[model samples]
Target: MRFDTVIIGGGLAGMACGIRLAEAGQRCAIVSQGQSAIHFSSGSFDLLGRLPDGTPVTDPVAGIAALAESAPAHPYSVIGAERCARHAETAAELLRSAGIRVAGDSRRNHFRITPMGKAKRTWLTIDGYLTTDDADRLPFKTVCIVNVEGFLDFYPEFIAEEFRKRGVECRFGSFNHPDLEQIRRNPSEMRSANIARVFDRDADLEALAAELHRCSEGCDALILPALIGINRNDSLELLRARVGCPIHLLPTLPPSIPGIRAQQALQHRFRALGGEYFLGDSVLSAETRGSRVERIYTANHGNIPFEAAHFVLATGSFFSKGLLATPDRIVEPVFGADTEFVPSRSEWYTLRFFDRQAYQAFGVKTDPALRVIKEGKALDNLYCAGAGLAGFHPVQEECGAGVSLLSALHVAETILKIEN
Candidate 1:
């Protein structure tokens, strides 16, 4: 099959790009091999939370400007602060249009409390996770953290203790799901996802809400693990309607329901805009002529070949298998794009676990236009975005979603400009 654009990787970057291109009336296809790294996302979009020197960033717009002046090779630097700001606005517009309402803005960031009781500064967060005021205000009195009986990841007591350390009047509460008896029979199946699956039913949710309504009375606000529902907005609305109070969600480890919902919303909008999506398939290889990619071959039922006028490489970094680390070298798997890495593997890591690791900064090297470069030459029709792009440690810098979102829109905008 042929399309105007073929995006590899069905993560946030690819989905964002596909949505924008499809909205612009381009034929687009997104190839995916099951779940994306988004399932592990905190459901918050972080721009630049810290400087390379480990300084916390309060104003992301100002941080980007400073970063552009200092680190010219950083992805945001190459993309430019002006374009990055514009792309952020465009990204917010597209996400809202796609039914994912986000809270926060581009100018300042909010230090959102994590399930681990630590705070992460982020640019935009999904609306359901924030307080009703939409400000970075914490519930001062009668704050309750709800823990599911069998959920291993979220510890309400630990979270409450942490909050107490910060002088917040926090309390912990636990509720045993009626369906817990069924899952307790199989210890292995008692995961957050399985529990969420059980909660997907309105009847199950209503029961839980009744329990919460009793437990949550006189509480100023209820902080729960993000397991309210997998459909996020719908589940949040349902829970709000039934429970009736201010609700804040804390991100738990892995299989993130909020992230899943965001991806689903983007995918839904992409398809609604006439884009094709091939899940449980991966781009195995590609055909390239000179600097232009001709087509890509996926590991479909018949080794399907997909041709596109433009190809986007959002396959992500080592975590997503976009880049492979070997005993000898770090290599880009599919397109063999040049990777920005230290030559010696010995320099890849530091002695202390708390210290920053060099390997985390390893990824693809992209030109200013966000095009993939191989052996010092930019590919004509190939673009790169997301974790695959080198120059920033996503965890340390807190710019994963920011880079993905902005770069995706930037790539789409670049393609549209060239076409125009």
Candidate 2:
């Protein structure tokens, strides 16, 4: 198959890039082996939550400017502050068009409640996650944390305890669902994904909504876990019909239902925009003509050749296996691109486990145009985005989705310009 662009990895970056191209009448394909990091995301897209000095960021736009000055090699810096802000707006608009409601933009951050009842500052969060306007403290009079009975991943009591310690009016409550009883009996069915499947049914959602309606009384807002529905918008609509108050969801454990919904929404949008998505398939090898990669071979479809005018690599960090870490060094696996990292492995980690680690910032070396560079030579037609591009520490700066979305959008525009 031949296309305008072929993106490797079906993560946020890849999907965003493909969708942008597909929307612009360019044929695009995303080859994905399995689930992306979106499955484990908090469903909140953060943009510079904290500074390099561990100081919490108040104004994210200002923070970006400061970041550009401090970390010029960072993806945000390479993308430019004004362009990063523009891409941020573009990402929010793109997700909104995909039926997801993002609450913030590049100007500032939103504070959402975590599973542990801690406040998290994020740039753009899926609607119904943040119950309060205050990022530092809970702004509600009475908060009710609802837990599904036998849901092991969520801890309502723990959240309640934290809220109480902070002198906030909060209560912990649990509701029993008929569907959960059977799932709880089986060990394998105890996962968030399994429970989310059960909730996907309209009857099951209505039943849970009914129970929540009865349990939550005189509470300012209902703080539920992120497992409200698998279909996201549909599930949220089903519950909203029965429930009376505003509801917010705390980020759940792995196989995050909201995350899955977000990922699916982007992929579905990409397909709807005339983009092809090959799931359960990975790029095996690329045959480059001089500095350009003309065709790529896939693991599942080895014999069939996939060709594109431009290529984007959004395979992600070590967690996504985009960049492999060895005892001595870290390497970009796909193109053997020169990676940004410390010379010695001993400098990869720091004494403070929670602090920014050098390894987190390790990824492929790229030019201002995001083209992969090895030995100071640029891979002309190939571009890299998301966690695969080196420089900024995602966890420390809380710019995971920011980098992914912004970089993808910027790269897509760059490709368009190059086409022109």
Candidate 3:
């Protein structure tokens, strides 16, 4: 197959780049191994939640500017704060255009309630999920934390305890329906995704609405786990119409329904714009001519190769197999791209688990243009984005989605400019 651009990973970065390129009349294709890190997301995108020194960031634009100066080799610094700010606006509009309604902006950060009920700073949060502009204050005084009867992922009592600490009159409630009993029979299968499948039907939603209406009689709002709207974005709206009080959702543990929905929605948007999507396929090797990557061979297509004028490596960090950690060194597996890591394996991590580890900052080495470097030479047609790129720790800095998104946009814009 031939395309204008062939992205190696189908995560947030690859999808965003493909969508941008396809929208501009460039033929784009993406090869995905399986699920990406978005599946474990909290349904929130972070820009620069905290500085390198652990100081919280209230203004993301300012934070990016500070990051550019503090961390010169970081992706945000490479893209520059001016372009990062512009790309931030573009990303929000792109998500909305793809039918993913989100709240918050690039100018400032908002607080999203974590599964443990802690307020974490983030850039964009999917709508219908709880977000407060101020961490010290909540919009509602009285609220009810409701959970499915047998769902073990969400603990309403823990959430209620946190709310009470904030001086909110919070209470806990449980709802059960015949439709959920089948899934509840197996503890392992009673997850957010499965519960969302049951709630997709109108009959099941109506039953849930009736139960919520009874539980939320005098409460200011109803807080539930993010278990609806997996297949349909309007599931929450439909349930809200049938209930009395307002409804807000809190993210659950892994197999996140909101994350899955966002992934599905973005892929749908990319395909709708004439982008080719090759899911469940792995890139086995790449064919390079001089400094340019001519084509890539995948596991599914044994002999045939995907040819493109430009390529993007968004395969993600070690967790996604974008980069491999061996006994002596870390490596970018697919194309043997240059990576930045500690020379000694003993210095890779610290004894404290919560402490910032050196390995989190290790990834492919890219130039100012975000092109991947191999043996001291930059690949003309190859670029790197997302967690695969070196510098900036996502977990420590809380800028994973921000770097994934903004860097993808930067690479896409660079390709478009080169084509023009």
Candidate 4:
């Protein structure tokens, strides 16, 4: 198998890079191992939500500029704020092109209502999800949080409690149809995805609309757990139209329907542009010729090698096994790429659970051009992006999505420039 580029992970970063390259008439292939961290998304993308000093960011463009100065070794710093801003715009347009309708802007950060009802700063939110320009003020004065009867994942009462604290009139309600009764019987199986499957039917959706109307009386808007649209936004749009009042979705627990839908949509767009997607496949080893990668062998296609001019490592952090930690050191398994980590393992994590941990910042070392370094030499054709690159704490700084997206675009732009 041969392609112009081969991406080793099919998460947001890999998909973004693949889509960008494919759109430019490059043959791209993405090898994915099951699901990515997108399954745990909150239906929002973050672009420098907080500075390294833990200051909440209001404007992301300014935030990037500050981030570049404070965290000089960070990926955004390496790309520079000017290019990061450009990539941010391109990333938004790319999502729209892939059928993912998002609200908010890279220039400013909006407060997205989390599942716990707390406001978290983010860059781009899915269109149906609730977001506010001001964290202290909500758009609707009165709201009713509705959840499925037996779904334990969504806590309508908790959300209502939080809303009430904000001086808003809040109510909690639940409605279940006969179609969902069977799935509701099994406590474990009644997840957002399964409920969404039942809601996919027109009749079920109509019933839900009627139920929401009943529960939403005297309320300015209705807030429902995101369980209606698994594949597309049409179901949520139809429900909102049928309900006759403003309806907003709150992302449920992990395996988020909106995130999965976005992933599927992006993959579909890549395939439409003549890109190949290999899901449930793992890259086992690579064949390197000095500083350039020649081919990579996968677990499924044992002996068959995927040959490409450029290779990307977006396999993610320790969560996805992109960077592994042994007793003595951190290692990038596939290509034996050099990693950035403290020599002492004792400094990996702090004693406080909520405190920033050092291990989160540990990842593969890369050059200013985003090329991976192996044994003190940068690989000519191997680039690293997303959570795999070193130099910043994602959770603490709140820039995971930004790094994933902008770094992918930066690497893609570099590859395109080299191609030209």
Candidate 5:
């Protein structure tokens, strides 16, 4: 089937871009595998209305946020932060309208104690959002934080100490893995969703539960990661029924399932709007002739022959790594496309994983028009968005999904020339 747009990589950026283009009345098809990367998402959308240079704005939308970025000439000019914030709100509203009500507001969310009084860092809550607060002064006798097996993040010690400092007794447990040593020796300070990645593979749930049991043995309240299992609703109902303690779910970061749920919600909306889906597809590369896309090749699939259309590549960075092709150590994954990326990985992430700056860390080099550039030249018909476009720190302002959606919307605006 010939699609007006064939978007590869079904993760956040890809999903966002595809949904936007499809909603813009373009015939679009999204190619993806089963794992949407939504499985690991925390689900809260960040909509900060101000840019980093402190440029004042109204409110954040779903696909974009407001932020100050450095253009070639200016020293830190404001750009996508507002755009990102805006996108988040729109997408979230779409979710709420779908009956899975999500919460967001112009007001900044606050941090608070978990029901288990685990992590010292406060959490945020809107009306439909998960409610959390600083548990420092709260008199909770026994509270527990959950963990998982082989999961490379979640700090039991850090959380325990924080609760201790706050004068609250707390317990740290693992829903990720059972091995204390494995959880203890996680080298990656940032959490990995490896266990969650394998959630639907028909593994032993009882064993998984036994491991959770091992971690939660003496806890009164069990604080598990949000989107605890493969099935969101089922996980909520099942775990609540099975676990004896008071069950509370907390939001997680990138590779978050909530992000994926946002994606799914968008996809359903897109399809309802007559968008086509091409699951598990690969476009070999673009065949261009004289500053225009000629045709797209696919191995064992079909071809996308384009004469004069634009393309948005939201292939994410190393974590999602759709843009990273690992062939014989040659590096770069997006076919033979040259990326005007940071010189090295050192510039990509800050040393501190907990630092919010690292998450919005990387993507493609492009102009303000969202065009991918290499040596001062645009890639003709191609544009980049999402985490694949580079250089916005998502963790810093919690703007990952917002950026993904906004830039895609920006691409749509360019495609449609929506003059605001």
Candidate 6:
């Protein structure tokens, strides 16, 4: 089971990385346990539109600029207006390649591209004040963000207050959590995994539909917690059919996510091109010496090892245990025994709470190249992208798939360029 690259997580970053690497004629595969995170995605990407210094953002350039200075250890720290534009251009190119169209908004963003490649000038704002316009206009009257219950990731009071302060009509949907006691009492596959499993099943999950019907009673659209109970096509169908509103899915934050299928949807093209899928596969360990990584190990039926001239660690964060956020949550432990990770602490969760709530979940701590870094050290042969990287909160702002794609593309380009 050798490959040019062995990506750890099956989420957005790993899938996207695998796709591009495979498309570049590199043999790539990803191993993972659960589904991806984008399944519960609202599917709308955006930026916070402000800097840590409180500078209001009129464009992506400024927002990215702020990210650089603040997030010196995460993602890119040098993305200026021009580079941001370059990012947008690169994203448009990638989208076009992916058979999707994405344009900027005439109201807020500078340009607009769609999956369909339609071009239109437009304006967008929380209120009808002509706040911002972009080259591409946003569709729908309200931008709905979905959150789940019991998860308690996003505090209801704070979110509702923020929306109220902004005068935006935000709605929520009810998702079931592991009533572990109740479930243990009535052990069944459907009830074993909580709401996420419920959404994936066709029958017996009707309780979720009933609850969704209740929570989404009169809201224009119901934004649900990340893919936990995300029915994808069915969710959109049911919400549209029963709730009668534009359903926008906000991807659930890391560690436990339900968007694996969404990643599959986006990765279908690459797989169709002959990419090998090692679903439920994993990396046991890697044997590396010096700056080069020689081989890695895994186990399915027997001991499986993979050899690669080059490698990419799109595995993910402590939650996903890519970088081992804590003791209980660990990953392959790249580098060696001395490579320690974040301390185990419940309080590691920041105070603002909502501050860490969004889909990106604080992102990953990386350098400009989007390589995961601990103490100013970039994990050689290891590059990171997506929610795992710490920087601007994508959940709080508009996480244009562009950011992840941009970092992923840039890293891949640099890797391929350097390797050749």
- Candidate 3 local accuracy as lDDT? 0.92
lDDT tens digits by residue: candidate 5, 97-181: 4335555454344343332334322112312223443334443456776666444444556656766776657766555433334
lDDT of all predictions: 0.84, 0.85, 0.92, 0.92, 0.52, 0.50
| lDDT of each residue in 278-316, candidate 4, tens digit only | 999999999999889999999999999999999999999
| TM-scores of the candidates in the order shown | 0.95, 0.96, 0.99, 0.99, 0.65, 0.59
Candidate 3 local lDDT, 356-403, one digit each (tens) = 999999999999999999999999999998989999889989999999
> Over all chains combined, what TM-score does candidate 6 have?
0.59
Prediction RMSDs, each to the true structure: 2.0, 1.5, 0.8, 0.9, 7.2, 8.9
- Compared with the true structure, what per-residue lDDT tens digits does model 2 show for residues 1-420? 999999999999999999998888899999988899999878788888888778888788788888877889989999898898888888989999887777885776777677787778888888777645574467666888888877788888788877776667887777777778888997667888888888888788888898778767888778888876776467776676688877778887787877898999999899999899999998878888889888999989878989989999999999889999888888887788899889888899989998679999889999999998977899989999898999988998888998998999999999999887
Candidate 1's C-alpha runs over 4 A off are: 130-137, 301-304
lDDT of candidate 1 over 1-420, digit per residue (tens): 989999998898999999999999999999988778888878788888888789988888889989977777789999999989888888888889888888887888887777677667898888777432222346666787887887788778777776676566876777786677898687776677778888888788888788778778878878888886775447777777888887788888877877888888989999999999999998888999999999999888356689988999999888888889999788988998899999998999899987888888888888888999999999999999888888887888888899988989889999988877
What lDDT does candidate 3 reach at residue 302?
86
**Is candidate 1 or 4 superior in lDDT?**
4
lDDT for 41 in candidate 6 is: 37
- The local distance difference test score of model 4 is 0.92
Q: Which TM-score value belongs to model 5?
A: 0.65
How much does candidate 1 score in TM-score?
0.95
CA error at residue 34 for candidate 6, angstroms: 2.4
Report the number of clashing residue pairs per model: 0, 0, 0, 0, 70, 57
